[model samples]
Target chain A: MRAMVYRGPYKVRVEEKDIPAIEHPNDAIIRVTRAAICGSDLHLYHGMMPDTRVGTTFGHEFIGVVEKVGGSVHSLSPGDRVMVPFNVYCGSCYFCARGLYSNCHNVNPNATAVGGIYGYSHTTGGYDGGQAEYVRVPFADVGPSLIPDWLDDEDALLMTDALATGYFGAQLGDIVEGDTVVVFGAGPVGLFAAKSAWLMGAGRVIVIDQLEYRLEKARTFAHAETFNYNEYDDIVVEMKKTTDYLGADVVIDAVGAEADGNFLQHVTAAKLKLQGGSPIALNWAIDAVRKGGNVSVVGAYGPIFSAVKFGDAVNKGLTLRMNQCPVKRQWPRLLEHIRNGHLKPNDIVTHRIPLEHIAEGYHMFSAKLDNCIKPLIVPNAR
Target chain B: MPSTPYVSNKPKNTETREELRARIPGWGADLDPADRPSYPKERLDPSATGAHWDFPERQAGAEGREHSIEHEIVPPVFGTSVPLKGFSGAIRRHAYASYSEGRAAHWLLLILGDRVDAWESHLRSLASLRPDNPVTETGVLSERRRHGIASRFGVKRSDINHQWIDPLIVGAPWVAAGGAAVVVVRKLVRRR
Candidate 1:
């Protein structure tokens, strides 16, 4: 099997590797049919995340056919098609019992800090990712949901991370019937988040981004008003003006550590490595919302410190809820949305590259070249 | 000559902060205008999120079936007290008399004259509760130390995490003890 091996920052190559065998009875070996390049994968590619060891695979968003099943994996069998969640969790853990699958206590020795994530850096438990011909799916009974016959393979691939996480971002906003929602960043997650916000009963949704292409996608796909932050004197003021000067009821930071707004802050946080990834997006979110508003952060940030305005958030009496989306938990509702024709997760996929060209895929996605919103990796593509 | 501290003409730290606010547009942007923060910048170290496997992959059974015990989860250790409590009274005394070197094997039969589970759980509880060495006092690991050595090397825990469990398990002559305990515990729970 050929797997995407992470050599270093800006270096990934699909190399021949042993087909991952089922390590446990509850595990299954999935022959990956499709995988997506996630916005967060850029964090690993840019070396923003810690403990990103060399030689590990670097994909999490994948859908596949179960090629082999462990004896204990009764929920699935060989030849069944399944889409594994990005998380690697034990369904029996305390966190899993409570539907907090992303914070599963049993999967990672680092579970005390972060949950186990497939193909993410070591900070997320060094489970190899799915951007390969074959990948091991852990806790097969819990994490991998069988792809419904109606769901497209690309849609199933997106659901593994981006779609579910975006929907979860809106769900975290706790949106009221007529709440106004603001989402920062027009990336794929933001696009899905804005689209999902409407499903959550948001009366008005606005997406803010510096990029024109994504903002256009926000309009056409998300069906929401869009703003380019660079065009305005202050994006927050514009948000306040749009919302009757009270600010939005909920603001989601879809852009994580690599947001580009403040020059010095970006340099110190992203370049100098003095702090964690840039806090600019999160800070902008805190600044843009109403005093008692909710801020939903689905953006991926490093474990290191980021200089944030904590005092202002405290003073404003904010309700902030964030986590890596427990993707399986959101699947039922997301499937319903897909069935009802409210969402088309696959529509956002702009490019499909063979597994062999993952290096080029990573480069194009990272450099924001070719207007690549979401790029899918076809593992068996010739 | 070196006694005098160098107080250059540059402004104090407070002035530097003020100058930054005047220079940077979004410096104090979102904060309450009426309530100005006295400090401009402060170094913050969030709790270090430890996400590393300090050890290599577990060398497993030829076919990879007999993997580490990190995946074998015990029932919820919280909300449920240990089933047997008096496990400590004999296990501790005999452990000191025999395996006091903290040898990872045979203390149970020598001391409490029982399986490794009771002795292991008891010793673990003791280790967690205020050992003279301050480092041994954390209760969080009580939940962790419960993982089967195999699971630590195999299932729930990643193989890459520091495999102190491997040495700890291999060093012991009683490798099968924990696995036996699992069967016993599962059967006991099923009967209940």
Candidate 2:
């Protein structure tokens, strides 16, 4: 199997490796047909997430065909098309029994303290990610969502991570009928979060991002109002003006742990380190939320941990919920929405590169070139 | 030129000073070193002067399943109790111990024990009873200090070393025996 191996910090290379076979009775081997670079993967590319082992295949978002399955995997069989979730979970466990599948105890026995996420670093579980040619899918019966024949690859890909993350964000925000929601960052997850809020009957959805293309896409495809943080000298004031000075009922920070933006654009960039999704946006969301409002965080909080202004959350009496969503829980509903034509998350795909050009895709996506939001990498590239 | 003051020689309650003396014994024995019938090394300890260290018998039934008992030391208000009354001896009817509540308390205590000082402080601040500060009994904290253990000086309970509560409580021999209370106060003093 020729797979893209994470060599070292900020370096990924296409390497030849043996195809993984099912080692456990619950395992299944999937012939990965389509895999994409996740926004979280960019964190790995830029050296933000350094815990990913060198030479480990680094991708968790994919749509694949089950080539083989162990005896225990009765629910899924060969030739079934599926969307794999980012986290591998055993259906049985204290957390799993309570429907908190992300923190499933049986997934990674070694690093068994916190939740286990696929394709993440050793701290998560050293499970080789799905970015390779043929990847081993653990807890196959629980992890993979069986895609119906009607849905295309693009639609299925969204369900794997981005769409699920967005739905998870909306779920966390508790988006109900007529609720006004504001989402930070118009990246893939943010857009999906906005989309989910719309589907959940949000009265108004506003997306905040600096990129002109992403902001425009959020308005056009995801049905969100837009705010470019770069344009407004005071984003809080700008967002407040839209919400009648009461602030939004719900604010979702899809950006997690973004370093300050230093991109020769604004003076604020100097302190922020990067012009991307960040925890500062979380602080902003807290400030921009109404009293008793909800704040849902679906952003990938990288390995970096720092101080946060929790007093703002406390002062506002805000209900803040954060977790790595169990995609399997939401995938079925998202797939139904996709099939019904009520949801079209595939419109976020701006670039589709071959698996060989994954490195190039990473560069373009990180640089925010060519209106890229979610770039799909067709590994087989037929 | 200075004469040392007289020091009292009371056997201070050194209960929480958990010492790992016994290695995991072969098959049949009480897990706790303190509860063991007797170890040869107990004769050599300076503190064991005239104190017969009677270790409990390793209670193993002939069928080979070893049975051991452990008492969870919870606050009396929180602890489960069986009322036996009439001011006279009667048939003692025992109550079934709920493992679920015990498990919950066990986890809660593990988490609470991690910041016992903060909990102690909070309890003191909230309670109507303004308990007096601990009389710094010199021998209790200082004997270990005289032996040059840095951990002996820290009054903050979180600063004390503890393994993951599960393995130590379940697999290891020691059992939690009893409880104690202390007081802490916050004050601002003017420095001359």
Q: Residue B104 in candidate 1 has what lDDT?
A: 33
> Scoring each candidate complex against the real one, what DockQ results?
0.01, 0.01
lDDT of 1: 0.66
Candidate 2 lDDT by residue in tens digits, A300-377: 754323345699889889999888877676665665667666677788887787877666666556545545688887
State which candidate has the highest lDDT.
1
Q: Please give, for residues A1-382, the per-residue lDDT of candidate 1 as tens digits.
A: 8888765444566667888876666678999999888989987765566545556788889889999987766678889999988987776545565566787665553224577888885446557888999888766777887899988888888888898888788777877655678999889899988887766556677999876777889888887789888788888889877765677889999999877778777666554445667898899899898878999999988766788988889999999878888787677767876886767888888889998767777766665555668989988887
Local lDDT at A16 for model 1: 76
Model 1, runs deviating above 4 Å: B1-192
Q: Mind giving the per-residue lDDT tens digits that candidate 1 earns over B65-171?
A: 21112334221111000112244324433433343222333222222222233334334535664212111211112223333333223222111232233234222
Instruction: Name the regions of candidate 2 deviating beyond 4 angstroms.
Output: A110-113, A259-278, B1-192
DockQ of 2: 0.01
